[model samples]
Target: MEATLKNLWSTVELVAVAAHSDVVEQWDGQTLTRAFHWAQYCQHLFHRFHDNPTIRRVMEKQLQLVNESVSVVFPEHTAVSFSDLSRCQHLLLVGLLHNTKLPVSLLRILFDTSSPVNKEQAGYRNVTGLCSSMIECKSACKVLSPLVEVSDVGADAEVQGVLLMERLEALLSQSREPFLDSVLQGCEGAAEHFCLVIAAALLTRKTAAAQTTLEDFLLDWLLHKHSLLQHMCYTLPASLLTDLAKRHVKFREAYCNVLKKWASDMEYSISDGEWFQASTNPTVSFQKLTEHFRSLSEASPSLWEHVENQLNALKVSDGDFDVRGLSVWGDLLSEIHK
Candidate 1:
């Protein structure tokens, strides 16, 4: 096993060097194919002999080799062709997601302002590819699964949660609209798992200071920007929702805070007429918000008080809000009363 591992490591190193060398010429597809083939084999070995310290360390070393090669293949501020970007995407998917270890350094590379993957046209394709790869990689699910498991909840879990949140924030921070849209779409299928992971991680935060930063990011990026609440309300299992609320005060508070912000924003939009002006169908938009709120309330009964409080505050401030000729506010008030 040791000999086999050593040979695989050598092959990976040789492939990395070959990829860098082929940068000036037409990239050898066989080189990439060989790289992936070896990587898949290594993934198998790592999983099977994960208990073996030697195999694990060697695998980490192999992954590091691949990670370093990425920077060489796609240098900073360089114009990368679609083919190169596509190849790099596959390399990243294999190096980052396939491994047991979190490749923080590789993420740093990808998020670097000058990294070719962050370039306008190429960045979109690269980001989309990476996000798509993430959705397809069952290993990523396995890696993140423990973070949400009730049995696995602990200090270590909290640390992992914080780490994951930090990395996700970094990724989102570097992303723009269409690229961001691609990410949100990729996340749709795994939305429940993503929400649970975030919830679990938020609950594990040890300090108010730490929790606040993550909460704001979740609200700004995930919940508000990506419609994470919609996903959570529609997809997250009811039992898990109850479990999360029952498990930690922080989780419930964070969730309520998100709802409060949405209500506050909606109230402002309605008051200023921006909500109606921005929407082709203000009534439909109002109805959707009301329905989402209803679903959210039903999914987590603990949040009902917070929701009601916010709605009442909005009602009091607006005094029978009307959008043009529509009685949307009255409709919302009626729905809440029911």
Candidate 2:
């Protein structure tokens, strides 16, 4: 172990085991808060190690050490505030994100469902909010871009796209209306990132959990948001369309509606939308869709249910669904049901 990682490993191990009870009482508030942020930054270093295979291997060792240290020290409901545990987990997530070989679907679950201190939504939103200004996004994406094409229907790379989309969806679902709405506006670019992040997630073996997460991302998005359905039907080809259609009933109806719209208006397709056009390269297009999909999937079930109820109240049916991609999805869905 290089002295640097060795030092970090030792420090993390010591800090990791210092149970919540140990910190809660002595909490300096500001100091611990700062430490939390510092830890997250360090974890980001591990995230980037994927590009440097040697560093990644070293990071794998250090990561296990750090994770074990934290797990032993924290151990769920061990008198830690949701805030603190979330901070720790969020730090871990940064590390996980940079660990490019991790499965994107697995990472998505870890981000979406793994609420260490009940702040997964805030934790990710805050990171994403800073992603544009932070150089980390560009750096991380460069490393991960090859692993995930962000385009190419049913490609393994899309799995990473799904995970990111799911994590963001969970976050959006939990956010307040105004805040959620604001995120929707900013989410386009953030989604494009994580080709590496998704790739990392995919690198992890495909377990049932991983596959379920993939399913969850697909079902969650299709069932909840029309925007994503709009994106997929227009941009993705038959394979993805078929996967989604086989999974849900409402999506089938919605897909049909989108196809009908495309037939009606050649000038306006989902591809023509600002979000879709952010990058014309298929890779870029796929990244945009992935990001949008993540944002849509990230919505919390409670909040998502509320959105659904509201849409229902407005009687928003397939007739009103004008996204151009819908018909491809419909074609796929129709085949699945058959």
Give each model's clash number.
Answer: 0, 26
**Candidate 2 residue lDDT tens string, 238-317:** 44443343444455456545544442332224555422332322333333333333333233454334333433333244
Model 2 lDDT, full chain set:
0.42
* Model 1 TM-score on a 0 to 1 scale: 0.35
Top-lDDT candidate index? 1
Off by over 4 Å in 1: 1-248, 251-254, 260-284, 299-302, 320-330
Residue 230, model 1: lDDT of: 50
Stretch of 10 with least lDDT, candidate 1 = 77-86
Best by TM-score: 1
Give the alpha carbon lDDT tens digit for every residue of 24-76 in model 1. 13323333334445544543453354445675566566556654665565453
Q: What's the CA RMSD for each of the models?
A: 15.7, 19.0
